[model samples]
Target: MAGLIDKAKNYVAEKVANMPMPVATVTDVDLKGVGIEGINYGAKVSVDNPYTHSIPICEISYTLKSADRVIATGTIPDPGSLVGKDKTILDVPVKVPHSVLVSLARDIGSDWDIDYELHIGLTIDLPVVGNFTIPLSTKGEIKLPTLSDLWSKNPPQSSV
Candidate 1:
């Protein structure tokens, strides 16, 4: 009886391993906005769904790191469902406090940008497969807003 159970478990594991799952990638990460409280960065993720029906996303978990230190981490629960047989785009927002940015002055002061690594987990529920997570990661530098960008020349004036 134990042998039979072991064989069955192997069969199930093999099937799960061969199953087709959704593909996801982190397309872009950019600085979105700045506020009095903090700076907002947005990560754009594109997921391709292979199923015929919409799949519910359990949650979107993200971790933002800079200078080998975690600056922000959070999860967005029940973000939405993915479109069937198509691609869906989702935005994950990370808010970095002014204090946190100030703490990384050494890295920022040298290049006028912050080097970052973003890790995103796209979790979804499948019919027979239970929960599946697609892990995505991206590394790049986010340029800090310059004083000139904020206080630059005025908009083009049209002659009346």
Candidate 2:
């Protein structure tokens, strides 16, 4: 009985891990530089199920903020009806002309001592598994910035 249970757990974990996280492309960057306002953003999320089993209602939330304060928040529409071998691409758009000013700089000027990050992650529940009983683990975030730091790039000094 114990052996059967362990096998079942491993199988479950494998199935969960192998599932693909819906990926979206940040098509364009509408906002730039300090004190800049009215930013426009667009993203294309492509949903493709690599697993043999079907994924139902794959919904993801996207967040935008100047810093700690959230300016806009919305949820991506999951593919309606049964998603078979066909992959669906969702084009997402958000229009925010003004945002609450936080300490975070709006501009990425020449000094470029700024931090702009795009964090795209998935949070969903699998219908096949038990609610609360089954743990739908969340993945880590992948962060990207325009530059490392202010004085990091000095054109590589040579010591003769």
Candidate 3:
């Protein structure tokens, strides 16, 4: 009886290991907006769901690091659900306080951008699998907007 149970457990493990799961990737990160208290940056994530039914996303947690220091970390609870049998695109917004930006001035002043590593965890409830998290990370530089660029968007009218 014990031998039969061991064989069944092994079979189940093998099947779970061979199952097709969701795939996720961090595609891009860029500046989203500027605010008085902080600057908002957006990260784009692309996920492909293999299941035939929609899965509810538990949460999306993220951390942004620069110069080996974590500048921002937060959790987005119950963002949304992933599309069934299709691809879903998620946009995560991160806000870095002006105080934090001042601390990273060295890197930003050197190249007008900050070198960063963005770490993200996407948690989903999968059928029979319970809760699963897809860990995604990407390293890149985030460029700060220049005065000229900002002015161009809302160019001031010449005094009449």
Candidate maximizing TM-score:
3
Residue by residue across 7-42, what tens digits does model 3's lDDT show?
Answer: 999999898888899999998787777778888888
Query: How accurate locally, in lDDT, is each candidate?
Result: 0.86, 0.43, 0.87
In model 2, which regions exceed 4 Å deviation? 14-40, 51-54, 66-70, 76-82, 99-115, 124-160
Instruction: Arrange candidates, best lDDT first.
Output: 3, 1, 2
Number of clashing residue pairs in every model?
0, 5, 0
**For model 2, what is the alpha-carbon lDDT of residue 62?**
63
User: Candidate 2: deviation at residue 144, Å?
Assistant: 21
Q: What would the per-residue lDDT of candidate 2 be over residues 93-144, giving only the tens digit for each residue?
A: 5444443322333442333322334444444345555221111211211121
What does candidate 1 score in Cα RMSD to the true structure?
Answer: 6.2
For residue 70, give model 2's deviation from the true position in Å: 4.3
Q: In candidate 3, which residue ranges exceed 4 Å CA deviation?
A: 154-160
For all predicted structures, in order, the TM-scores are: 0.87, 0.46, 0.92
**Cα miss at 126, model 3 (Å)?**
1.2
Clashes of 2: 5
Per-residue lDDT for 18 in model 2? 75
**Candidate 3 — worst ten consecutive residues by lDDT sum?**
151-160
lDDT of 2: 0.43
